[model samples]
Structures are given as C-alpha cells and as structure tokens.
Target: MSELTVRSMTEIEFGQWYSSLVRAYADEQVAAGNWSAENALQMARQSNETLLPDGFATAGMLFLKGELHDGTAIGVLWIGLTHPRGIADCAFLYDIEVESAHRGAGYGRKLLAAGEDVVRRHGVSALELNVFGDNDRARRLYQSSGYRVITQQMRKTLTDER
Candidate 1:
C-alpha cells in the first residue's frame, strides 16, 4: 500500500468537499434517527457553519485531504485543535472519510494515521472523535487504531404504546 500524504485542503477543494460532507452527515443523522430527512440537510449545514465560521481559514480548525504519493485522493479529515474538555494540546477529530471508491481498503487506517501525524506535528498530544453507534466499521477502525471509547450515549425509542 502506498503511504498516504496529508495536506491542507485547498479553497478550490472546499466547496465540493463540504457539500458532500454536509449531505453525508445529514444522511447519517437521518439513518441514526436523530433528524428527519426534511431538516437533516439544513441542520448539518448549520452545525458545520457554526463550527467553521471562517471556512477553511477558521482558527483552530484543520481541514485536510489525504492522498497517495501518486496524488490519488484517498480521503479527508477535519480536526479541531481545542479539546472539548479544555485539555491543552489535545485535538478533536470532527470527521474522517475515505472516498467511496476507496472504502474497504486499508486507506481508512492510513488516512487516520496521516491525520494523527499531522496533529502530532502541530504539538498535539492526543486526538478524539465521535462515531455513531450504528457505524460498526468506523468503530472497529478506531479501536484498532488504538482509540478507546471514553464515553458513550445510548437511546431507546419510546412509542405511545410502549
């Protein structure tokens, strides 16, 4: 497998990348029963905008693209420099996605390693991320990458009959 290279996402790549991210995130939310189809897209956009007010130049936010040495785009990773719990020098991974065509290959793991290296180079001591309960694949990848679950949120549907 070719080593993955990580680089800052160019402004030219942000538009299409963000669009796909928003749509996919919305779909994931809908699938997880957190949002209805009608409002998922809007909510995704709002959440992303709130997190990335300055777009690619947003302070403390890193938008990165992963590729092979040959320049084949393998995936993208979005990480935050500030840790959620106020831990200094820690980073949060907002998202990491391997292109659909590259799915099931080792690229996801490579992309994640690349992201970690980038954060480490920035002086970050640790990295964290959230994976939906239903995304078994992602959870497995993360676990195998040495990330342990520090917290979890569970929910149960309650119907009028129940």
Candidate 2:
C-alpha cells in the first residue's frame, strides 16, 4: 500500500532474477504453443543470451527491479535502449511482470509508469513490446494503458483437424 519505485538491478539480484526469468520465459513459450516443453528451456536461454550478450552489463539494455516503499518486490522491467531496426531513440520493452501475489493491486500500471519514466529520462521517444496472443490479461492491460497494436499475427492449429 505504498508507492512503487523502480531502480537498477544489482548483480546479486540479477543472478536470481535471470534464473527465474529464464524458467518463466520457457514456460510461457510452451504455454503459448510457440515451443515444445522439452526444448523450451534451452531455447529460452539461447534467446536471452543472444539479446544480453554481456549479461547484466549489456551496453544498451536496462534491467530494472520494481519494489514498494516498504521494499516488497513487485516485479521487474527489462528494456533495450537501442532497437535493431534502425529506429532512433526507440526503446523496446523486452519484459515486464507483476508478481502473481501482487497482481490485482494496480502494481502493474505503477510499474509500467515507472519504467516509462526511466525511458523518458533517457530521451527515448517510443517504446514497444510484444505480448502473446493467448495472454488476454496482459493484452487488456496494455490496451487500457494506451498502448495500441502496431502489428498483429494470427495462426490456426491443424493438429486437431488432421
């Protein structure tokens, strides 16, 4: 019931956060039907390594932790300052999450606002993120937060039909 604050993650925190992020990302991939459970962990690790080649010191990446004034961790926000498509000053939101235990407390929006403030301080003009189609809750949150869809993808599973 206090103000949420975002700050740079420490090395020790990064170690634990990275481990949990890898597992959670793998699980999310499997749940979204994007990767087989058997290979999801490996793939997730590879993907993360590719994006964060220097680990916590990656030059253009920012790994932030969100917590309340009382120091209860709400979640994390990971962002990339330099986008690949040659978009100047456009930041990419790699990940953001509100811990399950704190989900309905409006911490998500607070965390997002905090993250945006960080990006704004960096003089970044735009921020973008991708959400899995099946994550209706996340989609709704993003939409309600004034984030409009820039692109969309759709698929039809044929395994059941054939």
Instruction: Give, for candidate 1, the lowest lDDT window spanning 10 residues.
Output: 81-90
lDDT of 2 by residue, 78-124 (tens): 99987756678889998998889999888898999899999999999
Over the stretch 73-144, how does candidate 1's per-residue lDDT look in tens digits? 999999998986787778999989899999998999999998899889889989999999988999999999
Name the best candidate (by TM-score).
Answer: 1
Q: Assess the local accuracy of residue 42 in candidate 1 as a C-alpha lDDT between 0 and 100.
A: 98
Using lDDT, give the best candidate's number.
Answer: 1
- Give TM-scores for every candidate, taking all chains together and pairing residue i with residue i: 0.95, 0.94
lDDT of 2: 0.91
Tell me the alpha-carbon RMSD of every candidate.
1.2, 1.5
Measured with C-alpha atoms, the lDDT of residue 77 in candidate 2 is 97
